[model samples]
Structures are given as C-alpha cells and as structure tokens.
Target: MKILLANPRGFCAGVNMAIQCLEECVRMFGDNIHVYHEIVHNKYVVERFTKLGVRFVDEVSDVPEGAILVYSAHGVSPAIRQQARDRKLQTIDATCPLVTKVHMEAIRYARQGYNIVLIGHEGHDEVVGTMGEAPESITLVDTPEDVEKLSFAPDAKLAYLTQTTLSVEEAGRLIAKLKERYPQIESPPKEDICYATTNRQHAVAQLTERADVVLVLGSQNSSNSQRLKEIAKSLGRPAYLIDGAGEIQEDWFTEDNNVLITAGASAPEVVVQEVVNYLKTTFNAELEEVVTREEHVTFPLPKELRQLQLSN
Candidate 1:
C-alpha cells in the first residue's frame, strides 16, 4: 500500500489560537476553565481538555458564577457576550479573527441600510453567532434553492456575506445566482471563506484525484474537515472521517489501494502520525507527501497568559 499525506491538512491559525488560549487559561487560572462550546468542533481536542478538567457548556446559564468562561474560536453572537457579562463570569473571547471580520461586515452593512444576506449553513455555531450580529437585517441563505426563493424589493440596497468555512464551488454557484437575480446587489469586498480552509480543501481535492481512497482526519462536526471529505466523495472516491488511527476500518483499504490522508483544520498532526504508523505496521505502506499549500499563520496568545509566562 502507498500512503499520501497532504500538506496544510490540520491546525489553522484559529484552531491554534483557541487551543493555546485554553492551555494558557488552564495554566494561569488553573483547570476550572469553562468553554461555551466545543473549542473547535473536534471531539478529540475537547476530550483531551476534559481529562485535564476543562468544562464545556452549551449555555451561559450552566456556567458557575465568577468562573473563567471562554467563547469558542468559532465566535459567538453579541447576545452571548452580553449574557456572559450579565452572569458576571470572567470572560475570554477566543473568537477567530476571520470569523470576527464577517460579523463586523454584517453590522456595517446593516447600519448602512443594506439588507444583509449571509451564505452559510443555518444553525451552525459560527452562523448562529454571526446571525445574531444583525438579526433584524440579515437573512440566511444556504443553497441555490434558497437563492431562488429569495424575494425582496428590487430597489432595496443589499449586500452579501459568507461563513468562514464553506465549499468554494457551492458558494460561487450561489453567488452567481444571486448576481443574476439582483444585478445591483453588493457583495462582500472579499470572500469570507478563510484562506486556510480554501487552501486545505484544494490540497485534499488534489490528493484525492490520484488516490484510490481518501481518508480525512477530523472530528465528525468539524465543518472544514467534513467539507474535505465531501469534496472527495463528490468525485465518486471513497472517503472517511476518522477520529484517530483506532477508528480506521481495515475494510476500507484493500491490499493494493493507494490512500490519501488529510486532516481537518481542527485535527491534530499527532493523530495523523498515529494513523500512518498503524498503516505501516498493518499493510507495509510506503509514504509519499503531497504538498498543495504551506501555512505560516499564527495568532498571539491571550494577554493574561503572556504576562504569566513573562513573570515566570
């Protein structure tokens, strides 16, 4: 068997910042950390933190008063931030900078009298939080079907925004439809799909082209990772989302299969190593790395943690 490891597969700047924030929070404040949601929608990351005493909650009401509460990197609605303030919880905002950009655009466009249209999956954590930014002005559209159903005053000033992680092709198709319907509508100055997500998806797509089977290393709920898997599956290639090496079903690999391996933005590289090691032992696989993208993005750690490190 031959194994292909994709470049730029896991751990984007946002996920890196989020994980660092949690580590810093634990070190500075001790393990009584309360995160608003799964830090990055990856079960492995969350489970590892849980073992270290990090508390994960879906609602602000469940958080203990005066505890250190964190918003996930996926970002949160303004309402959520207000709720944390009302509860008197010590708060840390770990929202990804890119997601924050989209939220800001929603606010700016709404205030400028433009009706807002957001392209993202409804109910997604990021979408839900972003929607909260201009709830009265924004309408969510996920598909071409939704675009077709869109009905608004022809003369209404309008603008569009997008979720940070989305299928580029799908979003393009929708944008084209929107343009056709409202030739005068305004679009975001830039696409909201982050560079990391786009680069990783492109890498996964490239690797899957020559690979007999593609394996995506990501949590089930990771939007970027799931999109990578779908990109492969959409091409009629076999794909799977494995939490780790232990979840790799042997049945998916035949004796001569060439496997392509890619990790989601939230997945850790250590898991990829484990998967490769497992395949090496079981099938005597030879490894070849395919580089589609290189990433050097980094976000600074929270100030409180940085100060502690300096003091230490």
Candidate 2:
C-alpha cells in the first residue's frame, strides 16, 4: 500500500488566526472566555477547547454580561454584534478577512439598489452572516436549480456575491446559470471563495486522479471538507470523510490500493499525523507528500488582543 498526503490540507491562515485569538483570550482572560460558536467547524478542535473551560454559546445571552466574547471565524450578523454590545460584553472579531470581503460586497450592492443573488448553501454560518448584511436584497441559491426558481426579471438591476467556502466548481455552475437567466447581472470585483479553499480543493482533485481510495479528514459539518469529499467522489473514486485515525475502516482498503489522505482547512496537523501513522502501521504504507500549492498567508491577531498584549 502507498499513501499520498496532500500538503496544503489543514489549518489555513484564517483558522490559525481564529484559534490563536481564542488561545490568547484563554491565556489573558483565563478559561472563562466565551466563543460565539465553534471557532472552526472541526469537532475535535471544539472538544479540546471545551476541556480547557472555554464556553461555546449559540446565543449571546448565554454569556455573562461583562464576559469576554470572541466571534468565530465564520463571522456573525450585525444583529448579533448589537446583542453583544447590549450585553456589555467585551468582543473580539475573528472573522476571516475573505468572508468579510463578501459581506462588504453585499453591503455595497444593496446600497446601490441592486437585487443580490448570493451563491451559497442556506443556513450555513457564513451564508447567514453574509445575507444578514442586506437581508431584504439578498436571496440565497444553493444550486443551478435554485437559480431557475428565482423570480427576478432578466433586466432587473441585479448583482451577485458568494459564500467564501463554497466548492469552486459548484459556485461556477451557479454563476453560469445566473448569467444565462440574467445577462445584465453584475459580479463582485473579486471572487468570494477564499484562496485556502480553492487550493485545498485543487490539491484533492489532483490527488484523487492518482489515488484508488481517498480519505478526507474533517468533521461532517465542515463545508470545505465536504467539498473535498464530493470532488473525489465526483471523479468516481471511493472517498470517506473521517475525523481521525479511529474512524478509518480496514475493509475500505487493501495492500494494492493507493490511498490519498487530506484534511480540511479547519483540521489540525496532529490529527493528520495520527491518520498517517495509523495507515503506516496497519498497511505498511509508503508515504508520499504531494504539494499542489505553496501558502505563506498569515492574518494578524484581532486589534483588541494586540492592544491587550501591548499593555501587558
């Protein structure tokens, strides 16, 4: 057996920044810090933090009036922000800059009096926050079929934006359909999908070509992770999305199978290593690291944290 590991698979810059923000909060303010949601979607990461006494709340009211609250990388609606302020909570915004760009575009197009067609899965944290920017103007579409369901006239003043974590190919299909139906529709100045998501998907697509079976390391709810699995499965390869080593099944592979292993952007390197080690010990697999892209991206800590650091 052989193992093909993807290089740009786990912990993108945004996830790194968010995790650091939470860790810094824990160190500075102690374990009593409250996060608006799971800092990232990975189950292991949230469980680990929960053990450290960090509280992940679904509602701002769950937090104490004066407690420190950290926004997840997935961002939040303005109403959520207002609620935090109303509670007198000290807040740190850890939203990914890429996601923020989409929010900005939504605001811009809405102010310009355009009906916005947002390309993203409905109810996703990122999508919810983005639509909240201009709820009256924005309509969420998950697929080309959703585009057909749109009731806007062809000549309607329209603009489009996307959720940052969507599958590139899926988003492309929706955009093409939107254009077919509304030839005059405008697009954002930049693409909404983040670099990390595109690069990781590209890497997995490349690996799947040479791999007989693919193993994607990510939680069930991770959008980018699910996209990786879908891409592999779309190419007619057997793919599995697992959280860690224990979830791997012996029946899924044989000595002749070439396995491609990758993790989602929110997944940790330690979990990837654990999976790699398990495969090696079980199949005596020859491991090969495949690099599809080089990433040097780094996001600075939240301003509040930086200011606190300077003061200390």
Candidate 3:
C-alpha cells in the first residue's frame, strides 16, 4: 500500500503560539492557569493541558475570581473580557493574531454603520466571539440558503467577514452567493481565512486526487479539520476524520488502496506520525510525501508571558 502524506498539514503558527503560551503559563504559574476555551480544537492538546492542572472553562464565571485566565486561540468577545475584568482575573490573551484581525474588521464595519454578515458556522467559538463584537449589527450565515432568508433593504450598507478556519472552496461559494444577492456588498480588506487553513486545505486538495481514501487527523470540533474532510468527500473520495491512529478503522484499508493522510492546523505532528507509524507497521505502507506549499509564519508568545520570561 502507498501512503501519501501531506506536508504543511499540521500545527500552524497560531496554534504553536497558543500552545507555547499555555506551556509558559504552566511553567510560570503552575496550577493557577485557567483557559477560557480549548486553546485550539484538538482533544489531545486539551487533555495534555488538563493533565498539567490547567482549567478549561466555557464560562468566565466558572473560573475563580482573580485567577490567571488565558483566552483561547479562537479569541473572545469584549463582553467575556469585561466579565473577566469584573472578576479581577489576570487575563493573558493567547488569541491568534489572524482571529484578532477578523475581530477588528467586525468592529470597524460595525462602527461604519454597515450591517456585517459573518460567514461561519453557528455556535462555533470563533463565530460566537466575533458576533459578540457587534451582535445587533452582525448576522451569521453558513450557507447560500441562509443568505436567501436574510432580511435587509436593497440599499442597506453591508459588509462580510469570514471565519478564519473555513474551507477555501466552501467560503468561496458562499461569497459568490452573497455577491450575487448584494451587488454592492463590501468584503473585508483582505481574506479573513488564515494562510494556514488555506495551505492545509490546498495540500489536501492536491493529495486526495491520487488516493483512494483520505484520513484527516483532528478533533471533531475542529473547523479546519472538518473542512479538510469535506474537501476530500466533495471530491467523491471516502474520507475519515480521526483524532489519532487509534480511531483509524482497519476495514477502510485494503492492500490495493492508496491512502492519503493529512492533519488540521491545530493537530500535532506527533499525532500525524502516530498514524503514519501505524500504517507502516500494519500495512507495510510505502510513504510518499507531497509538498503543496512551504509555510514559515510565526506568532509571538502573549505579551504577559514574554514579560515573565524577561523578568526571569
């Protein structure tokens, strides 16, 4: 069996920065670290941090007053920040700069009196945080069908923002629909989808063409991971999204099949290697790597963590 592994498949710069921030928090403050949400969307990462005594809370109220609370890479709404402030939490923001850029765009559009249409999945942490920036002014739409149901005057000012982790193809289709519906609609100054997401999806798109089956390693809740699976399945290939090698189904594999393996931006390379090792041992698979793009982007650790390092 031949295994096609995708380069640029895992651990984007933002995820790296968030994970490092949490690690530094653990080292500096030990068990006192509390994160607002899953640092990224990988289960293994959250579990590892939990094992290290870091608390993950969906609500700010769950965190003890005045505790050291770190925002997740998904970023939080202003209200959540205010809540933390009210509780006197020592906040360390690990929000990805790309995500932050979307937030700023949302705020900017809202301030300009343009009704913002946020293109993202409902109830997603990133979407929720972004909508919270200007709830009254922002509308969430995941599909072209949702756009049809939107109620806005023909002459109303409008702007669109997108989730950073969205599939490039899916978002493009949605944007096309939006533009068709509102000829004068405004787009973000730049693409809101992060470069990491685009690169990983592009890598998967290139590899899936030659493979009989595709395996994407990431948590179910991970948006980018889900997009990768969708991209493969959309191409009529049988695709599976697994958190790790243990979730891999032997039934899906055959001696004659060529399998493609890729991982989400937040998924660790170690997990990808685990899947590769299992395939190699179980099927004697010959690995062929397909490099779609080279990525060198990096985000700095949170300012609070950097100052702590400097003080030491």
Candidate 4:
C-alpha cells in the first residue's frame, strides 16, 4: 500500500495567529481566559485548551464582567463586540484578516447603496459575521437555486462577496450564476476566499486524482475541511473526514489501494502524523508527499494581545 500525503495542509497562518493569541492569554491570565468561540474549529485544539481551564462561550453574557475574552479566528458581529464592551470585558480580536476583509467589503457596498449578495454557507460563523456587518443590505446565498430565487432587478445597483473559506469551484459556480442573472453585478475589489483555503483545496484535488481513497483530517464544523472532503468525493473518490487517527476504519481501505491524506486549515500537523503512523504500522504504507503549492503567509497577533504583551 502507498500513502500520498498532501503538502500545504494543516494550520494556516491565521489559525497559527489565533492559536498563539489564545496561548498567550492562557499564559498571562493563568487559564481563566474566555474565548468567544472555538479559537479554531478543530476539536482537539479546543479540548486541549479546555483542559487548561480556558472557557469557551457562545454569548458575551456567559463571560464574567472584566474578564479576558478572545474572539475566534472567525470574526464576530459588531453586536457581539458591543456586548463585550458593555460588560467591560478585556477583548482580543483574533479574527483572521481575510475574514475581516469580507466584512469591510460588506460595509463598503452597503454604504454605497448597493444591494449585496454574499456567497457562503448560511449559519457559518464567518458568514454570519460578514452578514452582520450590513445585515440590512446583504443577502446570503449558497447555491444556483438560491441565485435563481433572487428577485433583484437586473439594473439595480448590486455587488457580491464570498466567505474566506469556500471551495474555489463552488464559489466560482455561484459567482457565475450571479453574473448570469445580473450582468452588471460588481465583484469584491479582490477575491474574498483566503489564500490558505485555495492552496489546500488545490493540493487535495491534485492528490485525489491518484488516490483510491482519501482521508481528510478536520473537525466536522470546519468549512474548509468539509470542502476538501467534498472536492474528493466530487471526483468519484471515496473520502472520509476524520478528526484524528482513531476515526480510521480498516474496512475503508484495501491492500491494493493508494490512500491520500490531507488536513484542513485549522487541523494540527500532529494529528496528521498520528494518522500516518497508524497507516505505516498497519499497512506498511510507503509515504509520498505531493506538493501542489508552497505557502509562506504569516499574520501578526491581534493588536489587543500585542498591547497586553507590551504592558506586561
């Protein structure tokens, strides 16, 4: 058996920054930190932090007044920030810059009086936050069918943006549909899908071609991770999204199969190595890493965290 491991997989720059922000908070505050959401969507990461006394809460009210709160890599709505401020919580914004870019575009389009269409999965944290930027102007749509139902006049001033973690092919299809329906609809000044998402998806798509079965290491709620699994399945390969090595089922693989393993943007490399170790021990698999792209992107820690570091 052979293993085709994917390069450019696992924690992206934004995830790294967010995780670091949380780690610094824990170290400085001694584990009494409150996170607005899972710092990133990986279950292992969240569970590890929980073990260290970090608390994850969905609402601002859940956090004690004047406590330290870190926003997740997925940005939050302005209302959530206001609530934090109202309670005097010392907040660190760990929102990925790419996600923040979409929020800015939503605000800009709304201020310009353009009816905005946001291409993203409804109810996703990132999508919800971007829509909240200009809820009165932005309408969320994820499918061609959703586009078909839109009743905007063809000549009405219109603009579109996308979630930073969308599948490239899926976003392209949706954008095409929007353009087909509204010839004059404007796109974001730049593509809203983050570079990390595009690189990971492209790498997986290439590896899936030669793989008989594909394994994606990511949490179920991770949007980019889900997209990687879907991309493989779309190519007629058997793909499973697993959180770690323990989720692997022997029945899914055969001695003759070539397996491809990749991790999501928020997944840890340690989880990938665990899966690789399991495969090597069980199947004596020969590992080959397929590199589709090289990434060197880095994001700085959130300003609030940096200031806290400086004061300390």
Candidate 5:
C-alpha cells in the first residue's frame, strides 16, 4: 500500500504562537496558569498542558482573581477581555492575529452601521467570540441555504466576514449566495480565511484523489480538523478524524488500499508520524509527501511574554 502525507499538515503559525505563549507562561510564572478555552482545540495538546498544570476554563468568572490568564488562539470578545480586567487578572492574549483581524472587521463594520453577516458554525469558539464583538449587528449563517433564509431588506447596508477555518470552496458558495441576495454586500478588505486552512485543504483535495481512504489527525472539536475530514469525504473518499494513532482501526485499512494522511493546524507532527509508523510497520506502506503549497508564516509571542523575556 502507498501512503501519501500532506505537507503543511500540522501546527500552523497561530497554533505555534498559542502553544509558545502557554509554554512561556509556564516557564516564567510557574504551573498556575489558566487558559480561557482549549487553547487550540487539540485534545492531545490540551492534555499535555493539563499535565503541566494549566487550567482550562469556560468562563472568565471561573478564574481566581488576579490569576494569570491566557486567551485561546480562537480569540475572545471585548466583553471577555473586560471581564478578565475586572477581575484584575494578569492577561496574556494568545489569540491568532488572523482571528483578531476578523474580530476587528466585525467591530468596524458594526460601527459603520452595516449589518454584519459572519459565516461560520454558530457555536464554534471563533464564531462565538467574533459574534460577541457586536451581537446586535452580527448575523451568523452556516451555509448557502442559511443565506436564503435571512430576512434582510433589499436596501440594508451589509457586510460579511468568515471564520478563518472554513473551507474556501464552501465559503465561496455561501458568499456567492449572499451576493445574489444582496448585490451591495461588502466583503472584508482581504480574504477572511487564513492561509494555513487554504493550503491544507488544497493538499487534501489533491492527495485524496489518489487514495482509497484518508486520515486526519486532530481532535473532534477542532473546526479546521473536522473540515479536512469533510473535504475528503465530499471527494468520495472514506476519511477518519482521529486524535492520534491510537484511534486508528484495523478495519479502516486494507492490504490493497492506499491511504492519505493529514493533520489539522493544532495537531503536532509527532502524532502524524505515529500514524505513519503504524502504517509502515503494519502494512509496509510506501510513503510519499504531497505538497500543494509552501508556508513560511510565523506569529510573534504575546506582548506580556515578550516583555517578561526582555526583563529577564
């Protein structure tokens, strides 16, 4: 069996920055760190951090007063920031700059009196936070069918933004529907989907064609990871999303079938390698890497961590 690995599979810039922030916080301030969310939506990553004494909380109110808190890479609303401040928590923002950009766009459009339509899953951390920016002004839509269900007037000034992790093709179709309904709908100054998502999806789209089955290494809660599996399944390939190699099943593979593997932005490469090793040792699979694009993007550590390092 031949195994095709997707390049740029794991650990995108935002995930790198977020993990770095948590590591730095641990190194600088000790193990009593609190994060607002799962950090980057990978179970393995979260468990590793949990073992290191990081606390993940669903609400700012759960954090003890004056505790050191790190925001997740998914970003948070201004209200959450204010809540943290109100508690006098020492805050380190690990929000991906790209996610922050979408929040900024949402806020800007809201201020300009344009009804904002954010395209993303309704309960997703990123979508929830972005919508919190202007709940009164922002309307959330998950699909093109949702766009048709919207009850906006013909002359309403409108703008649209998207979750950074959405499928590029899916977002395009939804945007097309929006345009058809509201001819003057404003778009973000730039594409809202981040580069990492686009590149990974492109790799899967190209590699899935040649494989009988595909495996995506990421947690079930990860939006980007789930999208990778969905993309492969949409292409008529059997795809599985697993947290790591341990989740792989013998029945999912057959001696005659070639497999494709990719990982989500938050997944570690070590996990991907584990899956590869299993295939090699078990099936004697020949390995090939499929690279659709090269990524050189890197995000800086959060400001507080930078200042602490400078002081030390």
Candidate 6:
C-alpha cells in the first residue's frame, strides 16, 4: 500500500496562535487560566491545554470574575465580548483573523440593509457567532436543499458569506445554485473561506483522485476535515474521517490499494506522523507528500497576549 500525505494539511496560523496564546498565558498566569471554548476544536490540543491547567468553559458566566478568559480561534459575537468585559475578565481574543474578516462583512451587509445568507452548518460555533452579528437579517443554509427553500422577499436585497472552514467546491456549487435562483444576490466582496482550507482541500483533491482509500485526520466537529472526506467520497472513493491512528481499521488496506492521508487545520502534525508511521510499519506502505500548496500564513498572538508578552 502507498500512503500519500497532503502538504499544508495541519495547524493553520490561527490554530497556532490560539494554542500559543494558551501556552503563553499558562506561562504568564501559571495554573489559573480559563478558555471560553475548545481553543481550536481539536481534542488533542484541548486535552494538552487542559493538562496544563487551562480550564475550558462554554459560557462567560461560568468564568469567575477577574479571571483571564481567552476566546477560541473561532471568534465570538459582540454580546460575548461585552459579557466578558462586564465580568471584568481579561479578554484574550484568539479569533482567526480570517474569521474576523467575515464578521466585519456580516456587520457591513446588515448595516447596508441586505438580508444575508450565511453558508455554514447551523450549530457550528463560527456560524452561531456570525449569525448573532445580525440575527434578524441573517438566515442559515447548510445544503443545496436549503438553497431551494430560500424565500426572501422579491424586493429584499441579498448577500452571502460563508463559514471560514467550509469545503470550497461545495460552497462553490451552493453559490452557483443561489445565483441561479436570485440573479441579483450580492456575494461577499471577498472570499471568506481561509487559504488554509482551500489549500488543504486542493491537496486532498489531488490525493483522492489517485488513491483508492482516503483517511482524513480531524475531530468530528472539524468542518474542513469533514469536507476532505466529502471531497474524497464525492469522487467515488471510500473515505474515513478519523481523529488518529487508533481509529484506522485493518480491513481498509486492500492488497494493492493506495491510501491518502491528510489532516484538518486544527489537527496536530504529530498525529499525522503517527498515522503514517503506523501504516508504514504495519503494512510496509511507502509514504509521499502530495504537494499542492505551500502555506506560510501566520497569525500573531491575540492582542492581549502580545501586550502581556511585551511587558515581561
């Protein structure tokens, strides 16, 4: 069996900055820190921070007053930010700059009087926060079916924005459908989809076309990881979105089959190495990186963290 790994598959700059912010906070504040959510949605990364005494909480109310509270890389609504301030919690925003850009677009569109269609999974943290930006004006759509069901007033102007980590091809198809339905709909002036997502998906596209089986490394909640599996399956290849090597099934490796290994943005590189090493040692499979894109994007530490780092 052959193992094809995708370059630029794991840990985008936003995830890097968020994790680093937590690490630095742990170093600066010692064992007393709280994060608003999973720092970047990967279990391994969350578990690592938890082990270092970074307590994770879902609501700002759950966090004690005067505690240093860090927002996840997914970003949050304006209300959450205000809530943090009301509690006097030291706020460290680890929002991916790309996600922040989308938030700005949502606010701008709402201010411009256009009913917005946010293309993303409904319950996703990013979507939930974005929808909150202009709750009354923004409607959610997760699939082509949702597109067909759209019933905005004929006189209502429309614009669309997407969750940052969505499948590029799927979003493109949905956007095409929307344009056909509403020829005058205004799209986001810029692509809200992050470069990391597009690059990783492009890499997976190259791999899935050549491999018989595709294994995407990511948490179940990881949007981009799920999309990688979708891209592979859409091409008529069997695929699995496993968190790590332990989830790999022995029956998946056919005698002469090729397997492609790729990871989500939030996934750790070590996990990919573990999976690749396991495959090679167990099945004597050879591994090669399918180079599709080179990612050099690096988001800085959260604004607060940068200040704190500068002080000491």
Model 6 agreement with the true structure over 22-58: per-residue lDDT tens digits? 8889989998899887888888888888888889999
For each candidate, what is the lDDT?
0.89, 0.93, 0.94, 0.93, 0.94, 0.89
lDDT (Cα, tens digit) per residue for candidate 1, span 35-116 = 9989898888999999999999999999988888989999999899899989898888888999989999999998999999
TM-score of predicted model 1?
0.96
TM-score of every model versus the real structure: 0.96, 0.99, 0.98, 0.99, 0.98, 0.97
Model 4, position 201: C-alpha lDDT score: 94
Task: Tell me the RMSD of model 1 versus the true structure.
Answer: 1.5
Candidate 4 least-lDDT 10 residues: 31-40
Tell me which of candidates 1 and 4 scores higher on TM-score: 4
User: What lDDT does model 2 reach?
Assistant: 0.93
- Per-residue lDDT of candidate 5, residues 151-263 (tens digit): 99998999999999999999999999999999999999999999999999999998889999999999999899999999999999999999988988999989889899999
Runs in model 6 lying further than 4 Å from the true structure: none
Candidate 5 local lDDT, residue 312: 89
Q: Name the runs in model 1 displaced over 4 angstroms.
A: 303-312
Worst 10 residues of 2 by lDDT: 139-148
Better of 4 and 5 by TM-score: 4
- Write one digit per residue (lDDT tens) for candidate 4, span 1-312: 899999999999999999998888899999889998788999999999999999999989999999988999999999999999999998999999998988888998999999999999989999988888889999889999999999998799999999999999999999999998899999987899999999999998888989999999999999999999999999999999999999999999998789999999999999999999999999899999988899999999999888889999
Residues 56-151 of candidate 2 have per-residue lDDT tens digits of: 999999999999999999999999999999999999999998888898999999999999999988888999999899999999899777899999
Query: What are the clashing pairs of model 4?
Result: none
TM-score, prediction 5: 0.98
Cα shift from native, residue 52, model 6 (Å): 0.8
